[model samples]
Target: MKYTVSIEIAMPREEVIQLLADPAHLPKWLRGLVLHEPLSGVHGQVGTKSRVVMQMGKQKIEGTETITRREPADLREIPKGSVVHFDREIVVEGMWSVVRDRLTEAGPDRTLWVSESEYRFSGLLMRLVGLLMPGSFRKQSQQHMQDFKAFAEHGKDVREGKG
Candidate 1:
């Protein structure tokens, strides 16, 4: 399944991108995120790798993400300036899934974050499980987007002495 959502942040694109790129700040804003460990590379640059763990209800999902694309902030462009794209692979025992996030600046102090995912079931049982839990996937993705929006906008305000 594929789903996407975007929000306009009240802060500049650079600030938003910078905050999103930090691994430590993820759990603060990302709902259900319990752990984020950087495995390699710089904080926001390409080639960075991290292991992320998120919990929803009684279930916990673990994944590893690698920065595939990182664009520098361009103040002149304001909102449409920079973008950060990454690919994440989630392995749950026998089931494997892949998700990609393409986050870009949209307007002045606004951002557009899109997440696309393609999941492959390992066996008939896994396929059946996916069929039964379709809503789980969609809900998780949407919740993350909402959390990011709140975090970025609020974070911007806090940083600019607005809060």
Candidate 2:
């Protein structure tokens, strides 16, 4: 499955990108994310890998993510000025997922953050979830974006929305 979601943040594009790129800020906007440990390569660089653990209710979900692409916003001549891009491939259980993030400057003090996600499932259970609960994936992605918007705008945690 593939879909795109976006949110507008009341912050400068560079500030939004910097806040999003920093690993230390993951827990602030990733909801259940409790751990993000770099395992190999340079952190945030392409080819770098990391283990991520998230606590969802009583379940502990774990996954490994490989950074596939990282592009600065200012250096490109895209229609939108200063639109950064980041791509990561993540595998969890029987699921393989790729998420691409684009951060574009909407104005002098506003940013537009977009996320595109693709997910494939191997196990019967996972495939069923994909088929039946596709909205779950999109909801989670949008939640993270919303949380980030709140965090970037007013320094709030994921649980503390509308910051």
Candidate 3:
């Protein structure tokens, strides 16, 4: 399955990138995240692999996420009109996924974030879920983007249990 979701954040591109690149700020926006720790290399750097655990209601999903690409190693100075790219591959017991994210300046103080995700499932149960409920995956992705926008602009923390 493949789908793309996007949202506009009321923040500069650089500031958006900074927040997204920082592991310290992830839990604030990424809902249901239980733990994310680097297993090799540095967080956000190319080739870095991290263990990710997310809680979804009564289900717990654990996976390994590997950073495949990051353009302009330095996020401190991004030239105007240039887009920032972040790509990662995630692997779980019965599923493999790749997510490509792009960030561009929408205006003086606004950023546009686009995320494209693709998934491949192994095993009958996983494949059935993917085939039957593809919209759920896209909905989840959009929710994350919306959550991040809220966190970036209004300091809303998903862990706080308040919207």
Candidate 4:
């Protein structure tokens, strides 16, 4: 299954990209994200892999994220913001996920945050979930985007229920 979600963040595009590019601040916007640790490669560089752990209610989920691509491949260029893409494999549940994050400057202090997610489920149960309850997945993703917008724009700690 594949879905896309977008939001408008009232912050500079560069600032939003900076906040998202850091692993330490993940929990502030990634909802139930409990752990994010690099497992290989040069940190944020492409081909790097990381372990991601998340908790939703009583479910403990684990995934491996392999950085597939990044924008601004060169340092010296017309400076703006980032339009990065990454692919991840959910090891625990046999899901393939890719998310492309695009940030565009809307104004001097506003940004348009657009994210597209593509998911493939391997297991029968997961496929059932994808086919029968697609809205659930979209809603969850939208919530994450909204939470990130609030966190990035207003400094509202979404993980703390302030957003």
Model 1 stretches astray by more than 4 angstroms? 43-45, 72-83, 155-163
Model 4 residue pairs with clashes: none
**How do the residues 98-137 of candidate 1 rate in per-residue lDDT, one tens digit apiece?**
6777667676666677777777777788788788997887
lDDT of 2: 0.85
Best candidate per lDDT, number?
3
Cα lDDT listed for each candidate: 0.65, 0.85, 0.95, 0.75
Q: What does candidate 4's lDDT look like per residue over 1-163, in tens digits? A: 7778888888877677778777777888888898888899865667788898989789988888887776664323427554544344445566777877666777889878777888888889888877898898789889998878878777778667774
In angstroms, give how far residue 12 of model 1 lies from its true place: 2.0
As for candidate 2, its clashing pairs are none
Q: Who wins the TM-score comparison?
A: 3
> What's the CA RMSD for each of the models?
4.8, 2.8, 0.9, 2.4
lDDT of 3: 0.95
Error of model 3, residue 113, in angstroms: 0.1
Model 2, stretches more than 4 Å misplaced? 73-80, 159-163
Give me candidate 1's TM-score against the actual structure.
0.73
Error of 1 at 59 (Å): 2.6
